[model samples]
Target: MPTKKELLTNPIQHIDIKQHNVVPLVDAMANMAYSSRDLNRAAKIYEMMLLDKDCGVILCLAGSLISAGLKQIFVDLIRNNMVDAIVSTGANIVDQDFFEALGFKHWIASEEYKYGAHDADLRDLAIDRIYDTFIDEDELRICDDTTKIIADSLEPRAYSSREFIHAMGAYLVKNGKTPANGGADSIVLAAYEKNVPIFCPAFSDCSAGFGLVAHQHHRSAAGKPMVAIDSAKDFYELTKIKLENPVTGLLMVGGGVPKNFAQDIVVAAEVLLGDDADVAMHKYAIQITVADSRDGALSGSTLKEASSWGKVDLAWEQMVYAEATMALPLITGYAFHKEAHAARTGKNFATMLEPVTA
Candidate 1:
């Protein structure tokens, strides 16, 4: 058998806690056998990509990030020109609106609240709040009025999430529907200003619900469909945009629809590239999730699976097993700081999209 000295003599090929002062949370991550080093490495790789001009487009898949209070992080990315496109959940959009609309708060359940729960058997760690104060029957009516105003103002074609939200916000402002003090102006305003595209496959989760409710009322009153737009064509248009670009980076905040939808695109690109494609089309990838991977669920699957399918760059797949709220800020902050630093130092940065053609 090989001696311990022989094994010790081998060059270290991975990051070890002894070599660096990792964040305490990251240490906890390592202890759980998660890839903390991989996340750091991926951050470094992303920094390198941001420096590359040809990198062109950056895609972020955000799920429930707004509820996690990480909307600012995404907004920061857009402000710093780190992301050009986004695929996200409608619930998050709604949560942002809820937070902005009423100065709503996210709260942890007190012991009393937990003890008095009807579903005592369930492990209830979720944050809770009473929306009893902000329930406005007129809110749905306003949403309906806003939707009609937008349909009359803009072309009848389907719009990206960013576009949709902006139109609604503008209508609200024009009609003097003041959101509660300190409320967010919706993600639509941010998207509009930055010219970034935000797509929400499931739109009924938040304010969209109010919009739908309004639409139903309008249809009954006017004998016509109010929100009669089709999403199939929108999907087709998004697909065409991705194909024309032919390269992307995926930053998945959570699992579920957003994760699968973004990954599926990478799979399609891989198939198009054929067997000998050396340079990955989906170049960089990162995921922060709480799901357990033991069941072979999509949420828990390691980046290695994605690499095998050409959905991520083997060298840059970073998986961090932490809350998106905790990890995304750090990663996004680092990316933004690096970009600002590069701009100050006059250092040229570009994204690498060259396929290693054998």
Candidate 2:
């Protein structure tokens, strides 16, 4: 059994799409078969979204993508106007992205410890695992406490996850947790600076939940008003994005709540519009996943199936049946290199959503 320090010495470095030009490689895959061809088309669709001046691109995240070294890909997208708005699982926003914004890191666990052979020993040492990645539990507690601090600073009222996450970005800026301040670049910080809105519909399921629990308890004990999360407001605000930008696209990595939540906004928009709705469905859609639709789960379901619900348009939708980590960098990196001719720029959706600032 190795000491925790020895086990966690190697940190996972995020992949930077800016540093690599993958245009030729992805372009060559145009002639390939199976998932390769699918990925090639998916990348082209994303490029189309970028080139379309009227489209607002929403990036959806699920799984431990940031911890798996995909954080810089998102940061680059946010900074470069490649992505307009974001919908993600709480773990991606709080425990993974925001936690790292505070200058912590996800470490690489050796293969020997990845088989659950040393998990108990890991728990004893206050270490947590996300697949082969390691996060120091002690550092994560600080992330929780920092959320409590942010909660304590806010006016005690129900806030949509977008509003709260905007505050998180503000917190990072005020504390110098940005590349300019020599701390670190992060998805949250970049989105803040770029005025990109990030929504975590299941807002309290991550480290923020523990912090909010502490916040509520302390406030109750002291007989004071407490901050609260409004998931309904999260849905409403995101739906407003759909209403505000009728021409929209989705680039989803993995699936689950974020996938369903982003897709459902189209239906939610139609519900709000009633007679005036143009049967609003996400205009361009791409999903990179390894899930099987046979499971009957939301993640595995096809975009064409979503069209049956009036949530997605079947004409421009593509499902690349591959794992995100392997597929995402190629897709986004391809877009980054081929972005010279794109007419679309940052929508500044956060400013459109509300006046929350960092």
Candidate 3:
């Protein structure tokens, strides 16, 4: 066996290349010898997951990906059928709605601006500029009204997040609301069109909160029992989804509740499949994050920890520590473009790069 000192001093050899552009990055990934072998290896894992017929579900868990300006990636993934289900932060969904509502944009603040004593106030510093461009009153009122509608329509029985979003979308379409602005319109339309399911275990934390409050008001008006969300139902739905899908893949963008929620699905899959599953439960995972693993934050927890629980395949999982805004667009674009190229050329693009299994 190799000594720990040797392993530490000389880690496994990886392809090495230094370039920031997306084309070069994709080319490097395509040619195994062109760049960091670790990255190349990671790309292969992703490709395998995309191609695997058994891999019916792809779960993306992240924080603030919408705020990072990666809604296009989400839209693209849904368009391409890259993801069958999504488990994401409510904040991300809310931010996406905000973006669609007012066509808001995000700008990079200087380090000085971020480090200032009044940094928290900086959010509002742009408010005047925002109001100059768009009004919030209309947006808030629309959100409130939509929440009320969804609350009134929801059945008393437990429903998955995707179901609720779809119901809301149908309602909007019936009411002649274009599914363009930040409403269940986009999500509902995409999922319904794709036949995909989305489960947000922490749905209440997001705009669902507003819907829940509206439900409370509706109940008050009807003099009925106020229905509170049952956490057990969410947990059960997650476990059930994992069991039904033997080959699972996770694409975690950031961390927080979404991160853990995605990870837990893999664990549930392993427990449910046991030894009979051929593809290996949760065989592929990719994460783009900025949190520090050394800090022991849940978002920063490494794939290695998940492997220990058989939640992830140690040989196939990939971790890319970076911003979602920077990574998601590039990867999504590359994957979809590759798929399109394959479709036109009559080639199996999904299997172009094979996983480097141990």
Off by over 4 Å in 1: 1-35, 56-63, 98-163, 169-186, 267-280, 340-358
Residue 239, model 1: lDDT of 52
Ranking by TM-score: 2, 3, 1
- The TM-scores of all predictions, comma-separated, are 0.67, 0.98, 0.72
| Model 1 lDDT, residue 171, Cα | 53
Q: Per-residue CA lDDT of candidate 3, range 162-263, in tens?
A: 556555545545555544544322444555455555556677776667767788877889987654555555555666656666667777777777667766
Q: Candidate 1's error at 315, in angstroms?
A: 2.3
- Report lDDT (CA) for all predictions: 0.52, 0.91, 0.55
lDDT of 1 by residue, 1-358 (tens): 2222221232212111122333444324434543556556555656666765445344555554454455555655665577766667765655444334333433333233435442222213222222211122333344444445565565534444445655554554554444344344445445545555566666655566566556557666887634434454335434544565655667777777667666666555445566564434466677888888899888878777877765666766677887765566556555555552254221111111111110
Candidate 1 TM-score to native: 0.67
Candidate number with the higher lDDT (2 or 3)? 2
Candidate 1 collision pairs: 51-349, 51-350, 52-349, 52-350, 52-351, 53-350, 53-351, 100-184
Report the error of model 1 at residue 89, Å: 0.6
Task: In model 3, state the lDDT of residue 296.
Answer: 84
